[model samples]
Target: MARRGVWELEKITLYYCLQGGSSQGTRGFVEERLASFAKENPQIQFETVIEEGHPEAVGLYRNGYKRTLSLRNLEPIEVHDHLLYLRNTWGEPEQKHSKISYGVISNTPSVQGYWRTEPDLEAPSSVRRSYLGQIPPNVPPQFRSFAQLQRELGLAGVTELLQNLGCSKWVVSGMTGVKVKSRKKRD
Candidate 1:
């Protein structure tokens, strides 16, 4: 008779935790669910590697194990910003408060800065129209009020508003050769 060889299976580790008020119940529920899930799906096996500390969880993931649950939940805005930070940290800072100011340049044409304002009109109405054109034509009735527009445009915030009616940040910075300085801090 020929001798048979035994194959060895590699071990996998999984990380999970219970947070806040119902940690005990949450931990029990997760353990029960995972056990049942593993039984139902044998193709994917999970083994609890460690039960304590943030370093342990990080190690599990680093060592090729999957995390079972998020440690915390964030608001929609917070989630958006967090993802934005992960993707890229370089860019104009996010607009927080709106401010409005006006000034004239010697070589450059006179333009408005800060909150929404009328255009010089002498330059060209097309440019002005395009700047204001960003406003959606089908604005809901509730948001059609001037107050709503002001709020949406960031006109009532702490930062000053730019007056160039037709120029967007791109055009102002690129075409007219104006530099925009953001007042927000970079993360």
Candidate 2:
């Protein structure tokens, strides 16, 4: 997108209906601002076509690529911005974008452990902490670990108790690795 130059755009055509309500802003833009814009961008040919439809701005590139943008109900400034955007574009079809995860990327091994929102699912039950730091006095000794509390009350009940105790999401998330030991043993 950075490499796209305005010089690549050979022509810009603004289509509008002379009497349509949706084309009112475009009409005003053509009448008041388009002349100056054309004068400023002397390299590109600016043409205004009066048609019976909603207003639209189209850009034709030197590579035979074309891009169109709806100008319906847009103010003169907005129309100018759209034109500027069109001038800078390569007229390529839109592509799907992946979600960007913000985290430290390093070639070397991290001195401190990497940050995690959720616990390691593959870790053994004994390896995972039942709670974050020390347990508070309000919590009973019988329910020393979050796993013990979860077994007696179930997940929903445990969540309610945590909420009532004013535990934040971070606190609960920290204890997600807490898995209770099952009575059945593998041979």
Candidate 3:
């Protein structure tokens, strides 16, 4: 069909099997709906060819390019949608999409590289080594263990130990540099 201001679509050929289960929907479309569809789009020539394989539709363009859509096992509505899609297209070979689409280009390379959740196994040992099981080297001696901290301070310390172990309410007095701020009991 020659669109007034668009590319010309010459013809569409529908191919379907006569007895295959896969062509049931295509047969239904041909028997019940094809006539009305052809009448609706009068500019294009529609032809049906009996074939022995899966159902498909091929649209030929005046520019010599053709588009094929598989209609195997599709509902009548889906088959109609595929025909509409083929009718609207320009009948050119599809282009492969790229990772970057726009014209914007970065002059500088990424310094930090791609973000990752896990450590890179391919990296150097120093870069990938983790302190997950054993204690990290940067921890202070007093912060290491309660026994070691009690031996260093020489006091029967329970609240201090719990405070060191991250209890914020039990404030330790006199040994650590922090002063205890008394809070009034809430009613």
Candidate 4:
């Protein structure tokens, strides 16, 4: 998707009503102009349906996404413009963007300047070694299991235990975390 290649509308389903305000005129214009346009583009297939509703153009792409443009009360030139728009575009939703800058390669950290290509050039820790956030490691007095932590503190103790372990999605508490809830209160 980064480097877009030549893309043409795979299929054009022109739907128009048999008896309507502008449907008849739109259908006539399509038969005369748009039908031949599709023929010129061999990769594009055209089909006209006499539906019971208003005139509309439904474009089908190879990626299985469909786009529809209502051709209500429009002239042949206007309909042609809309058709060209659909044919050229990928048929995706439009979003407003002020400016687009190069995105940092995902693995490369884009936030704080903590990343370095050479590991040896890294800075040493700025905090104390005692509670330097070394977690899941045996913190002498800290509870390692959720049940043990709950017994001493309470349910909120289990939450704090998880928070201490970096609170990342990859970090998860085991069944001990849930089974602790079912235990009767200690009198």
lDDT of each: 0.36, 0.74, 0.71, 0.63
- For model 4, name the residue pairs that clash: none
Q: Is candidate 1 or candidate 4 better by lDDT?
A: 4
* Estimated TM-score for each candidate: 0.23, 0.51, 0.51, 0.47
Model 4 score (lDDT):
0.63
Q: Name the runs in model 1 displaced over 4 angstroms.
A: 1-13, 16-23, 54-68, 71-187
Candidate 1: tens digits of C-alpha lDDT, residues 1-187: 0113211112224343444432343344345554554464343334564354321111122224322233233333342333223222222234455355333326765465444476332324575344433445655453345324434654323122443333233223212222434344459
Question: How are the candidates ranked when ordered by lDDT, highest leading?
Answer: 2, 3, 4, 1
The window of 10 residues in a row where model 4 has the poorest summed lDDT is 170-179
Whose lDDT is greatest here?
Answer: 2
How well does candidate 3 score on lDDT at residue 28?
Answer: 90
Clashes of each: 17, 0, 1, 0
Q: With candidate 3 superimposed using the best TM-score fit, by how many Å does residue 48's alpha carbon deviate from the native?
A: 0.3
Query: What would the per-residue lDDT of candidate 4 be over residues 22-98, giving only the tens digit for each residue?
Result: 78667767767976777667777878888788899998887788989999887878888877887887756675554
Query: Which pairs of residues clash in candidate 2, taking residues 3 or more apart in a chain or in different chains?
Result: none
* Deviation in Å, model 3, residue 98 alpha carbon: 3.7
Residue 75 in model 1: shift from native, Å?
20
Q: Model 3: clashing residue pairs?
A: 1-9
lDDT of 3 by residue, 1-187 (tens): 3357764677999999999988999999999999999998887899999989999999998889989989999988889999888888776887757887744357886687755797543434442233112344565455446335444553335445555655555332323322333445569
